[model samples]
Target chain A: MSLDQQPIVSRNPSPAAPPAPGADAVLVARDLSVWYGSTQALRGVSIAIPRNRITALIGPSGCGKSTLLRCFNRMNDLIPGFRMEGQLGFDGDPVAGPEVDPVTLRRRVGMVFQKPNPFPKTVYHNVAWGARINGYTGDLDELVERSLRRAALWDEVKDKLNRSGLDLSGGQQQRLCIARTLAVEPEVILMDEPCSALDPISTARVEDLMEDLKAEYTIVIVTHNMQQARRVSDMTACLMLDEARGNGHRPGVLAEFSPTDVLFTTPKDPRTEAYITGRIG
Target chain B: MSRASDALYRPRRGLRRALGAGFAGLCLAATLSGVVVLVVLLGAVLVKALALPPNPPWFAVGEQLRELAAFLSRIASSTNSPNPELAGFKAGIIGSLWLLLLVALIAIPVGVGAGLYLEEYAPAGRLRRAIQTNIANLAGVPSIVYGILGLVVFSRAFGFQALALGKMLWAGALTLSLLVLPIVVIATQEALRAVPPSLRQAALALGATRWQVIRDHVLPSALPGILTGTILALSRAIGETAPLLMVGAANSILFPPSGPSDYYTALPVEIYNFATLPREEFRSVAAGGILILLGILLSMNAVAIFLRTPTGQRAASRAIAQLGRLGWSGRRAGRSRTGLASAVVVPGPGASGPDSEVAQPTDQGGAES
Candidate 1:
């Protein structure tokens, strides 16, 4: 039987080859596959995230967009039974290896979770904890203020910096989380549906903040909202479930990777077209 | 309406409502049964402690009140005597307090540390589950079982002279510590588990190491819950007599323990000794001793409840207020006859459950779609 005709053991080429080197790619994944125990979640997938640009990973639920984002910072290490195969890179350096310290890797590639997960601590402490623990020797007060300002949060929270972060509005708490990530001075920011918990106004504000932030930091966001992927991203990667195998298990595969405008406006893979046109996910 | 809609909204309405109300009534009755038993016991203890007249106290309320006050003062101040009028639990009280201090010093650090390791560091698998199950089962093992274990392992050191601790005060303290260690561990685990996983994830994603995550976010959030659980466990320890007996607590002693090595007798052990005596006088003295022990236990448990209160200001002031109320009401009106007993029994089961005190919103809006 042909390779494609095999039930579940067959391998296929990635939907797209990884972007060539010197595309100014800061984070790159090649033929990356992930498994949680016996079940595969991500199939062979390749993509490149350019430096100083917003790269959005968009797909339906169960498509491993968040899984890919977490792999960049190795946050997937926290999940028991999570296993990844294939190369993941940060700043052109290998990241998905045992020799690398995840704590250090996470410092350089910080993340914001799907929900607004502010510490139940003072606003200032929430922003400062990362820097303090990462041993930032600079003035913490100045760093906190600068980070909050960068996240468009300083003015709203300056008066109550000592108040519990949990007291803030959901949008404000998300911004505080962004501010916290920024405080660690990471070069790459991984966001897993960062604005999904916020209202439209907050979403628009966060979108603007992302537009503003890309000049200084590379960003990779996993969003279920196709409109959001179109609105804020420079490069977009679409992931989708591969064909269901004989046993009915389907794993996520990269469907398309290109400039956001082209991917959204023009034709590409039939699956991408179907997803963009709302016929399939 | 469609048949489906009718089934969803109205089918079995009468029976369901009746069952719900019946269940609620059953729970109320179940709860009240415990409180009623506790109240009756407290009432009996109060009558015995005051040695109240059977039927003539209606007109001599003032005289009876004075006598009650005098009895309380005498019990609080005097040492144990074979003479009923002079008998008191001064040595027992002092010794129990010493045992409490030592037990807290030993148990808190060890139990909390073990809990932290199990919850945070231990790999989740068969071994962790085995240890967890064993610790849980240990919490249910009887106090006398622990007393026997203490006698063999801590006091006698299994007949090894170099390790033998003998029947020293520290031995008893160690025994009680073992008796309550599982409680402390279970409570600490529950407290640590109460801290939301999101907090840990947030900290970890910020590049904080595991230790940093726990130290910076997890520990602080879990502290109040841990304190509440530990205090309740200690209260349980304070009222234990069987373990102390097994570990060789003195039935009678002249002076309170001066140090960990000194021979000691606890309030419960002393009360048991007096209660078993043939004289009616010793029984009343035992009753007073029971009152004193209950007061301490209830106050500790009250503090535990106050700590569970989410607001810090209310926690501090309410704990102080409750402690004061317990002392004053127990002394003056004997009002603890109902209120204190019920408070003591209800919170034991309630507070030991998951840290329900902090109501974290569970909905993860849009939840990673």
Candidate 2:
């Protein structure tokens, strides 16, 4: 199929808010909105996914947390009748347009979906895949070892590098997913509730892994787990629904965005407080 | 107790439930008729094969059986040498083997590759949808039509004269391969789909390219399943008759197809040829041939069943499950080359390092559609 790719070469190089830099702000989402046919899911959402830090988006069910996160990498484009209006840029390149290829965009902004999706391959092959595709030429074992180790899966999976990745435990599979993502060496990594499906032990382990991951690459995660948000993320964006059903049909909107500590301890919106305090979903 | 069991325990107060159970039992009994017929046929054939003749000769019922036994006896008992000869079934056996090889060569790769492309790489759109529907339709197209296509295309158009140099053999192989292509594609696609999409995403996320992820993870994981399905398809191709007729299979050929250009007689074709005969003895030979065909099919299936190569993940899962609650040291102790069996969930690495980890799949690499 013909994939659309157009370079927005002449984009205004200025941002509305400058994220204090340590690592570059690799991906910037400006007023992104999404629709599934006539049904709107996200409405006028803006967020800066900074590099080398884990930014967790937390909200209740039907709050458009996952939808806004998907916009950053344009994975929303995959679903038929799934449309988005607004701009998402990767490293100053516009990603939220038909002209921008999702495949190419995904290569740079690697993603780990909610489920641990280890390919039906050997553990070694799974980690080595991204490097191979991008024309990597070096010691493969070293690369595999490095990625797996980073994912905390290398020590466990080293012996059976030739074995299929599916044979791993749930936690291991999620880590394998993480390792697989690392293989591509994407600047921005999107984890869409990576630990939501795992057991408590696995969730804790994945949280630990996320903490380690933020030291290297920018991470954006969408989760319903408030505890996980507090544990793994440096910055947190809380989303909530407005009483729009009474006014007219409208999608969920972001209630507040701030540093993780500040947002959890003292949220700007009463809706955010209501959610964190278990008063309202 | 299970909710279903509890529901059943709840007294059936209505006639409708009783009627429903009766209908279910009726459906099952009806289905068993087909199953019983198959079992009975199998039992009859096996019994006939095992029951040796009680007469003095005590020979098999195949056409060349009595004569070959005589010839062997003469050579052994009389100390007289005999010219090296092959029984009729020998030619049939060789023809069948070569045809299977050719079909496997042609049908499997194209079918599985197409399956992979359709399931993995293809975008959901009009063209891909059309191709998928076309493949489904092709699977349902009459086998006789494939035979006709083979005849017109290979024999008539390409001028394939015989099976000696492998002409009829190639034609028949191509026709049979076409007949089974849709099956393989469908089987492979299903097998691939059964595999979790996370595996693909995991590989892709790991800095693996799309091809790399598919090659390293997706293809290998789906290998055993795809192979099993393809072998099933091969069995279907082996027994085909109408397609052979289309591709110029010999009526009563005495010799095996020596090359790609020779006239060949396959098992079904040989059986078909014998069954159409005027003599009662020839019909027995055909029945004997039917036994032989069953034997071949069973053995092939058995071999396929026996030759299951476990995927890395399967082995790992098994090993890991066995080592339940084991720590790193215990995991290490149980681990061999079998797989990396552990429950550790590590964070992924930053993008940097050598890219050589992704190796290409060995067997199906260039062997293509």
Candidate 3:
């Protein structure tokens, strides 16, 4: 039950990248590992996501960066038979325990997906769905307007709130999605490649939104873009997958995790160094 | 991203364009035939409707037209027919309205509820597949078959032995419910499927219970669709004489049906009775009755089509947007001028309840807004 005394994973690199001193612990994912049938996507990864800050999970394709973020509030529970060993805790409670209901936890941890999956509805209706589901019975006009405002998209989309979410350009739709999440008031926000579908300027807008939002919610982002990690993350966890001959398995691993400035400047691990230098992923 | 580069490996541009034109032409030709068929059928209905007449504009059923139009002037000016079958038509119109009410009440809830259960809760596997296939098969079954079943189960056993809502309106309502239940359920499921899973997830992420989310968000978005399907099905039920026959729909009911076992005869049954009469005068009466019947059928269909229209669906979404605004109570009370201004001032925390920690500041400067 004690997280600190749990067996140290031998394959894990040195503790040079442990949560920095004095940082607020929001989501403490300790000894987290995920398996989908015979294939293990994540192996014994531990990282501390700080409160009111962005912790970017950067990695190449097939790594379990996104998987770790899903564990924060057990979004993985939606996927059948997705088992995780070791305790990933929130505050001090188990993230995936029976006592931690997925519905309530999900409310505390909202997510914006890679593709902007807006409901096939008008912009006003799309923003309103979050509050309505929570049995909110108050002034709806104000709630809808406030959510759009927080996402910094109300001005652009305000006049056309009645228009379909689909009519907006791809960038606008993504911002709409962010507005929808803001409406929910999640304690933590998990973003899985939130800007991958956007152009560079759109990507910058989202990154700016991320910066603005982190003051109120813990943000954990999983992205393929390296420059994005340097730009937005306070802590960067670079993940990679290499052949594991001992088990004849090819599983994604966390190569190194360090503060964003340090990781991009001077990563301790060679694989981390190679990944940042664009030599090997 | 040059056009030439994008087209480099594609068939030579001119040839590709020619092939594209040919394909478009083929589709156009096929579509044209469909349009022609629709026009011809519509033309036939109008032409036949015009042939029956003794009044102004020959084909017009004066009093029936008054009822169809529901115009104050027409209702006052139109003369009533001395013909009894034509007289009984007033009763049929009333009956059809009552039937529409019954169908909507009994079928909509059952069908939509079943659909939500099947789509949102059921796992994708054998049992789900079987239920899906069963529903498909049920939808495909003829309305006449449901009529026969209604006669046996509703008229004989349940209505008689149980004495629950006897040969009354409920019996016909029951039969029609079974007849259209599959269609409503199927539409509801498709509507639910059409809603992005992200919406469901987003709601759950905001401390919403499953039922709450379903009642407020999912149901509102899906309402127009469910009603559209149920209305379409009810319109189908209105035209059904075969099923009502097995359940003992009377041929000469001078009065309108008030309840379950009143021997209800819908518009179709009324038309059928007139068409079978030996008198030549009765045939024109049937034609007039047919026009009335078409009017009722068309009205129900028009309502269904209206519900399915994009504008109608958006209208149904008003309740949901209202609920979303409720989650932010105070700032919305003050004007923000723009939807974006109001949204930014809306509180983020305590989204679960109203008056829960609104994030708004200074109620002052928004005055200009």
Candidate 4:
């Protein structure tokens, strides 16, 4: 309830630093704890996000994986009663400081929601709108085309750019959301369960798109599927709910942070192994 | 056959069917009861307003139509009089129209602005909650109470002669506006709330300012609903007599008020005066006034209903999008304006010119928007 009385999280026996110790970290969180009106959501979630790499956060439901993803863009600020303590740095700058506007931060770090939420407008407008609102002085048509192409949705939607974005299939709509985010030219793309609503084929397309995207932009994705974490992510962070307090303070804490292959093949913590092996959540 | 299957097949289908039919019949009766009463009231008003002679109209339908046309023309041109033959609601009609326009101008923006502020901008606090609760309570307060408030506040200006509006058209208009303000505010709030939070989040995530998110996404999406709700509130205000009476509207006027400060009379006030007369012929005149008032109210409701439909909502949203594009593109180069307009202006199917190259991709195996 009080800042000084915030719950301390149990850390891994091994060092909590990610496997990529020397890699250029774009986002770094240290001793970060979050609360929503006295109900703690995340506790001491410390991790360094390497630049231009696909980092996936995988955990069971209500484990604060989404909350952690949202914190990168300051999206949790939208929620009422949301409060946080400790340091969250983006490019060596304190993100929650007064000098940094959340609007500016969001422009640099874009997000795609769990459900595909396309604007109720034409496909062309949906992509061009972000650029237009950000006061893009270049050719809007070119930007829209390039963003759609990068999302791998240009060829399918080129003939019908004038159609409503809602007219697209669930998969295409998700891709359209991606293209919309891309048009803003964000350095980091945060995806919260992007493929959970899509079929296998659409999910495969998105995974491939993610693989293509990591060569340029840093991506932080939160997914429930461990296989998705294995298939696309270069690095993975596994989180588990800390219910041991037994006082209704169920906060999520990081269990392991390692390279994707290493984390999946030989998890350091027993909880991570339990989660991956489907023994317990 | 299995024993369970035999038992299921032999269950009491007759009793179940009878019970379902009985329940459905009860629901139908409940619905028709209200409809039947409304139909009877409308029939009575129609007969009296037409002044049809008993048992003589069935064979003379053409003659009756000609007389009806004459009656309508007479009412359209003439002013109220003591004699039923010369009586009409032309002054009332014109005055009510002016009052409606004034109320719309005064109430709509203020009410809707308050609603938007309360729903979107206002912080969650005790003051905001108190304001919200007061507005909700104001909507349920009696019309006559509003009338008394209007009498003291708008007409008399609390004994300040210099500030008094003096029972003028503006005073009555202001009174009606105050009376309907709560309705409009509540309706606007409901409309704003109906817009999905996801749309706002989508816009906000794009680094749009709060105002930009509301202007570009939320407002346009809520326009149809707001329009319908506002129009319905306006209709309710138009039929209100008690408030206008307290505000000192004239029961009889030779001509409609030509300016805001001039004396005015509304349809409901004139009808009430006519209906209270001892003469039998004046009742017919009152019925005619009633018919005219009903016609106005019905048309307003029809517009509201139209705006409520999917087709109407889509058309409204498209027009808003077009307006938005024009404003947004006007600031940019004029060359791109035409290109953007061409893309947005033309509907998807069977179009030529720049949009022709863009084929319609209709069969996407998705839900219809």
Best by DockQ: 4
Put the candidates in DockQ order, highest first: 4, 1, 3, 2
What candidate 3 gets wrong by more than 4 Å, as runs, is A2-17, A36-40, A115-187, A198-202, A205-217, A242-250, B1-88, B123-125, B158-166, B319-369
Off by over 4 Å in 4: A1-14, A19-22, B1-20, B52-56, B335-369
Q: What is the lDDT of residue A86 in candidate 3?
A: 78
Task: Please provide, for model 2 over A1-281, each residue's C-alpha lDDT reduced to its tens digit, 9 standing for 90 to 100.
Answer: 11124222223232322353454466666677888887788887766666788888888888888888777776665567898887777777787665776677777888888987766545776676577667666544566777888888777866556556777898898898888778777888888988878999988888888888877788999988898889888888888875676546568787787778988999878898999999997
Would candidate 2 be rated incorrect, acceptable, medium or high by CAPRI criteria? acceptable
TM-score on B-chain, cand. 3: 0.70
Q: State the lDDT of candidate 4 residue by residue for B1-369, as single tens digits.
A: 477668657568899999999999999999999999989998897677677343346468887667656776677578988788898888888899989999999999989998999999999999999999999999999888888998899889999999899879998999889888998898888999999988988888889989889998999999999999999999999999998998989989998889888999998998999999998877877887887889899999998999999988987887776676545444553333323334544454474333221222111111122
| Top-scoring candidate (TM-score) | 4
Question: What are the TM-scores, per candidate, against the unseen true structure?
Answer: 0.86, 0.74, 0.76, 0.91
Q: Measured by TM-score, how close is model 4 to the native structure?
A: 0.91
Of the two candidates 1 and 3, the one with more favorable TM-score, higher being better, is: 1
A105-210 in candidate 3: lDDT tens per residue? Answer: 7777888888887876668767876766665666556788888888889889765665678888888898888888877777888899999999999999999999
- In model 2, what lDDT does residue A220 have? 91
For residues A1-281, write the lDDT of model 4, one tens digit per residue: 22222221222123665537445778878889999998899999888888899999998888899999989888898899999998787876677866679888888899999999999887888998888889888767678888999999999987678778998999999999999999999999999999999999999999999999998999999999999999999999999998657676789999889999999999999999999999887
> What lDDT is reached at residue B287 by model 1?
91
Candidate 1 residues A43-127, lDDT tens each?
9887767789898898878989989999988988988999999877776567877678898999999899999999866676688
lDDT of each: 0.81, 0.69, 0.72, 0.84
Per-candidate TM-score, first chain only? 0.92, 0.89, 0.91, 0.93
